[model samples]
Target: MTSPQPLPAYSRDRLAERLAAGPVVCGEGYLFELERRGYLQAGAFVPEVVLEHPEEVAALHRQFVHAGSDVVEAFTYYAHREKLRVIGKDGILEPLNRQALEIARGVADTTGTLLAGNICNTGVYDPADPATHAAVREMFTEQVGWAAEAGADYVIGETFRYLGEARIALEVIRAAELPAVILLVAGHEPVTRDDVDITDACRELAALGADVVGLNCVRGPATMLPLLGPIAAAVDVPVAALPVPYRTTAEQPTFHALRDPGPTPLPEDLPFPTALDPFTCHRYEIADFTRRARAAGVRYFGLCCGAAPHHLRAMAETLGRTPPASRYSPDMSKHVYLGADTRLRAANQAYRTSL
Candidate 1:
């Protein structure tokens, strides 16, 4: 095969241009997937894997791209100083964040996808504590600065449970003069943790210069969809919708609230975080969500937490895209037992009768 072509430097207009045109797909959930791969720990989710194993992180980025991601999001989700300090490794915080950006930068540059620097819920944002609020800004500022220096096309501030925290992130991104996609985590509450109505919070962020605003993470498609319509109607900026691939319901509005009713006991009382495998939505389910989200006026289509490449591929295809990974889409026609192909062995086909 011929070597790939080298393109000119990015103009950083990709996010705005793409959103103005149509939907753009961004894949998240590096921490969960990397933990499952045994390269990182789950509880802390510090993403030191990016520093320890940069190549694997790059490969994952490429997989997401192949599966139809329009952006290669740097895996700095929990690489903040606060998280590292909890693990007694705040010393390498900057290096870790920079490494994550570098790894994602390589994939985006090579594949011609938009590179996005990411900051998420700092977890220490206490509304009453003015000190914690300042700390969060310091964390976001440094991360966004590194992203801008790394030539990232834009920055994504996602999974903010407090509209207040999300607003701070938007302010930092705007101050950097880079486009901001601020996504809040609605969790199980109808409003943000600070009691701000979801629609109003999204509108407030949009008015504050957020290029895009919507809900992401915590809730699954089933729970997240109901909120998208209102928020889309409330905000004029491009709306973003990215839910986890879990079967969250009205009874259990968030994945953490899901209870496995099976006789077999889960490790914990609830089946969130590490034990949500059974609730994972199939690709077809994701496809359905994708179609609904597109129709709801969500221009930025993204997936978080429990997302895998196939889940992303399904969303992409539903958005009218035939990404490169579509080449390997499942074909029952090639199955020996389930398929009707004449080349299939008769013995294997006999199982059609439930043998």
Candidate 2:
């Protein structure tokens, strides 16, 4: 109910010192996951829950921390002033962001986890329009200042579709002297929304002084892996990938377009609207993605939309580390079953031996 006193700011050097320890596992997807849990309204997409329902937001942060997330990112993904204005609650932007940070900071402090301040795409990012560029800068400046004051260890600018806008965000975060990460949403394509080559864009973003640079949201890991190759090859800094947990195909690249007007399905009955069901990735699949990402030199791994605690646990297991306490675990008494492909391969090998 009361505002938290500002914490000491972390310098960029301090952030780098933390990163040098090892890879970081960040947990995002709060907006979509909350919507799935009936905490947020569909289509509205405002993170008003931080102000109205801090417990729900804090509970989510705790889940991620317990699921092995090293970073507890504040739920400010859509808390931008412009976004609040759409809902006629622009007056609450500062309170919403500050409160979100307070919740995350509390969890991080208790768990010894790092807190990341989240900033994302502003729909109006026109390089040619000076007024729009100015507005974007002002927006990020205000949001970053609030996050920094709230004791965020770093700031993440994610789900950006435009390179120009991403650059602006990186500039603002860097100017604050905090470590900055810029993640773009280019689907499976090798180009930005503005038609800039993704590989080239990664190179440029790194030059812009982003501590980390890579992709998030839009596509799932299978589709996002190939895209990360060029980015890893391009940047010397650590690369991050937080893809959605859906089986995204070439046809439906972005998750935003996957929404339907039908009623929300129960959690037990996920991957509804059978047409897009194939896009959903299971927990094991997320583990596989983590393995491949590590092989590709991606050190900062995380999940985006549809990600749950199970997915993060799987990722930790795949990395050959002990996972944090989880609500579910594999039944050791049951015989594990490999897929049909494995069975077919075994049969072929047996036949060859008999020959």
Candidate 3:
């Protein structure tokens, strides 16, 4: 195959020109209110028929719009055809996706916020793994087609763990010819999954015609820095950084997933927790991620797993400090944790002399 073409030069106005003039932002990439609304079961997060609490969902959109998000995304990430088939509602994909978009559009109309149609990971990666991609592509094409037809300004293919899957979704978006952005999952280290470095994956997807290349999910803002550098430099398009509120260490696998039928405690639910708040955890991470990302020249910003309207509000506040149409300039290539300053100093001294 011939070498891929270079990514087109990005002009924010040219990109924004395709979209209606507005704040043009999303509150969060995904928000799960399953247990809170009594939809909890074995794994109620992926349920059939949307299980939408209409008033609550609408209110969330309004909250984000009021918080200054120009775009409000519908809660339709997992509403795929195959997912619905498990619960025996294969016919409702169009309606549910439409309803989800309508919910956001209703609030958008009232508050003048743009609505973004959201598509998410199929929960199963490695599409090349025999018969894996067939159904997912059909489901995504149907869902994305509906999203494009439902007056969505743009679509976000988010929280993707594999680049191959992202490219499939990107192709679907291209078929619809709707402007699109991709959010990949880059783990805390230089990890490779399915023989693809998460950072290289972002650049490849952009070459396939993704409008923006960035990251979402992964551990948290503190550890995602290693992956962001390559994506920011390799792709000429806008780079967005949205880290999830996950555990700092591998000690707790259940930190993100709920354990019991208990009140949804904020991140601070644990007594020993001193840093991240449960309810506003995404905001805390986003605050730091956006700060460093802005310094790294990332222009697009949003949240991913374990995010909410509050986090989006904080991101908007941070973005507003410097208006759009301005350029990004950041210093400090390296950052050391306050607790590790001593060791970092020693390491820096040794490396400096070697240089």
Candidate 4:
């Protein structure tokens, strides 16, 4: 018989202390990652896997930490009641949220990592419906409560397309007395779903007590980087940047809006959620993004959808960190054809270009 794992013990209010020290990196994109690992359903995107496969969730948190993330965000990006109800698993909401926080909490304590509890968009938001607004607040209250009860160091309310919804999440996190990191996912139009401009949304959220505020999700490096400058200038707080790892351009800004340049039509003509491989940025591109974001005043760095351990390592190396994964960063000199080592064969080295 196997022994039971010890309950996770979390330490609170550490995220503010971390930011006071310097720029910090948080690992995100748990939904896509777990989906790629065959443990999650992509379209549903709810984190029921936390209840069914706790070890897998824990292992991902450890991987991000090992790759140089300063924070271990709980795998609860879409664990709210609204998302659970969409997937017909509303009955398991409490257990799923608790399990995700527990898994993340345990992993965070091991490496002394900053633990972040996550809550994302609620799918159902209406500008005119008072009932909808109440529902959104009710949902955030429960998730925020679970995070606080689970000892979250801070809570991240991310990818809110509507500034109205962002306000609700911020209000709840403030009431819980946890430091809040609010990130808005502006679409291709440079405005939130509610038509509030991205910069104004971030600035207002910062004014409303978001400890860290900036852009995250939907858009990639190219499209997302431009918005950071204005938001950083508008707010005194540390700015966060966590774009998806894709090659988005001016004409087709967001990842969902990207059109393949290779002239071969994509199978679905929609390269977002699962078919975004061709548009994924190389690790070196991620490193370049890190350097540029730092220059643009983005103090909190991460990747959203399409994030992998290698991308996080690249970001860390750019910031002069040597996380455990840095041990294997490419050494081209070791290559048989491109060798600079004394033991290399002259003929193979000389044939590099032709081969």
Candidate 5:
């Protein structure tokens, strides 16, 4: 392999400066939503859409940024070389990442929002094999280099299931002299895919100089909330919680296990494709989680898969801030019509003739 390219000069202290000012509201989970809406192929999950359909990608970023996202993450979740290779598009990794960053940069520049260069699980890291380890490092180095070249404010290594793989990505991002956020995917057991304890993992990543370390993607807020206190106690850096918007129950801690194999449709009640509307938390619920997370010392907060613009809007409102696009005046009237009591009262009033 050729020598790793030199990264452009960028401020490594920007993320820390931004975080110190206030909480960060990020918008993630573009692949699942884009595919469900017919913008991209479902099974292939190719990220060339950034290059082929830049408008659509930029539009999504605009929605999040307008909805109060502090950071507009590049839609490069599965854009890694190895992931592209699975779909026979390995040769376009550079273009895919570069275009994705460019789109995100444009949105951020227009809205005055920060841009995060994203890198997720590469699906090629193996601690047991020396060759695989070298390949994994090189893959991350190349990706981070592209992001730095595109003027990303910081780099986030998220949704990594394996501690080793997450560490590798963190190392590469740090080597680029950019602030790094490392997010791990956890199950109900409070352990990673490799069975390492989450608290232990956070401590290790923090020790390795991760600017921010926390959990995301595998479980919903209800499931991930229980793990936050321990992680906060384990690490000194800010804790991040970007759970999926779905109601991930104990029976199905992770979203991937929610569906069976084959083309069979999930049960109508299942909140797979319709997560943004059905399974997502209301603004009040997001407010409640934010309150709890703040109490738990979690500084960075956002949504993972199944997130929509409204979710970010609610989060920002709950934090007592208005987004760039403020449509409604601050009022408690909407909350009055939102709970079970309102529905129960209406049902009770209408059922008098049933006797």
Candidate 6:
């Protein structure tokens, strides 16, 4: 009889600590050659490229590693079957997905770094919409499973819209016996279907199985900064985030308000305001994003969308010189303890003497 393979032992919090101990992981998303070569459509998620230009994938991974990313995520975020079908390479799903993980591992070995398994929502948001739930779960399970099999140190389910999808993905990671982090995508709205509020959502995911929870790839830093406090108040786990700011007036106020029973605004009718100009972003904006992120007690920070090497370099420099906060100080904890109901009750003994 063949011996059984030993299960892997890992959890989410341990992964969070590892990420926190080092410089922030920085990266951006772009299509691989397979997608660029007309094998895939323009808007759908791109597949992992194994048959072509594996060296290019490795090169991209090395760029982030050399650019000072403590963790370099693989480009397997869209390696799920549904996306492969869009790319006409449905038959190559397993091989391409596995190869993406291998490429990430190889780059990490050469660069002496950490590799985050890339898993993402199938770009579907609504759980109640029966039209897509099963498909979503199936894609998440397959991609996450492949990442685990390829020996990823950790898995990242990023840019997810709903908690249901996030929960389903995390369950798969647990079944695979792997450590996982979930990065939810928040809109202008706050509360989600679960009544877990953002911070509470983080706590709930942590309690369920997530090791770290935070936001990524929604609006720019200005908008994202405001939500951090509520999110912090709701969860005890470490937060990791990457805010993807828009490039120009063409992207602002991205969400639409309800039009009365009258004519709805077409895409052509909407106005795009440039909250920050130049399509990229200003130095102060980047610095401010870092400042707010730190204030929110975020343990990890990175960029998306318009972020480039200079922007990342600016963030690294800005954080290096910024003063650390005293929120975790002994005095603060003592004050909190003394303000608690137990402490208050203990201090009320003088009333007994009066009685």
> Residues 6-36, candidate 3, lDDT per residue (tens digit)?
4344333334652333223556734443333
Report how far residue 276 has shifted in candidate 5, in Å: 8.8
Which runs in model 1 stand beyond 4 Å of their true positions? Answer: 1-12, 345-350, 353-355
Relative to the true structure, how large is the alpha-carbon lDDT of every model?
0.88, 0.81, 0.63, 0.87, 0.80, 0.64
**After superposition, candidate 4 runs with Cα above 4 Å error:** 1-13, 261-268, 353-355
User: How many residue pairs clash in all the candidates, one count each?
Assistant: 0, 3, 5, 0, 0, 3
Residue-by-residue lDDT tens digits, candidate 1, 199-297:
988988887778889988889999999899998999788999999999999999998898888788777686777889889999999999988887888
Name the regions of candidate 2 deviating beyond 4 angstroms: 1-10, 256-278, 326-328, 334-355
With candidate 3 superimposed using the best TM-score fit, by how many Å does residue 328's alpha carbon deviate from the native?
A: 28
Span of ten consecutive residues with least summed lDDT in model 6:
321-330
Using lDDT, rank the candidates from best to worst: 1, 4, 2, 5, 6, 3
Error of 5 at 220 (Å): 0.5
Tens digits of per-residue lDDT for model 5 on 29-60? 78876876678876567777798889989988
List clashing residue pairs in candidate 4.
none
Q: Pull out the clashing pairs in model 6.
A: 12-211, 199-234, 247-279
For model 5, the superposed segments whose C-alpha errors exceed 4 Å read 1-11, 259-278, 329-355
Query: What is candidate 5's CA lDDT for residue 110?
Result: 88
lDDT of 2 by residue, 1-355 (tens): 4432322344676457656876778888898778877788756689888887899999999998888888899999988988888889989988898999999999999998888998999888876788998999999999999998997889999988889899889888877878898999885466887799988888888876778999998788877888887799898888999998887656656654454434766444434323344456888899889989988889888999778888888886776656566446665332233333343466565555465
List the RMSD of every prediction in angstroms: 7.0, 8.2, 11.3, 7.4, 6.0, 15.8
Q: Candidate 2: worst 10 consecutive residues by lDDT?
A: 332-341
194: Cα error in model 2, Å: 2.4
Candidate 6 on 129-239: residue-level lDDT in tens? 876777887787888877877777778888776788888787777777777778887665655554446665666677775767888775567666777766766766667
Q: Give Cα distance to truth, residue 51, candidate 6, Å.
A: 3.9
For model 2, state the Cα shift of residue 296 in Å: 1.0
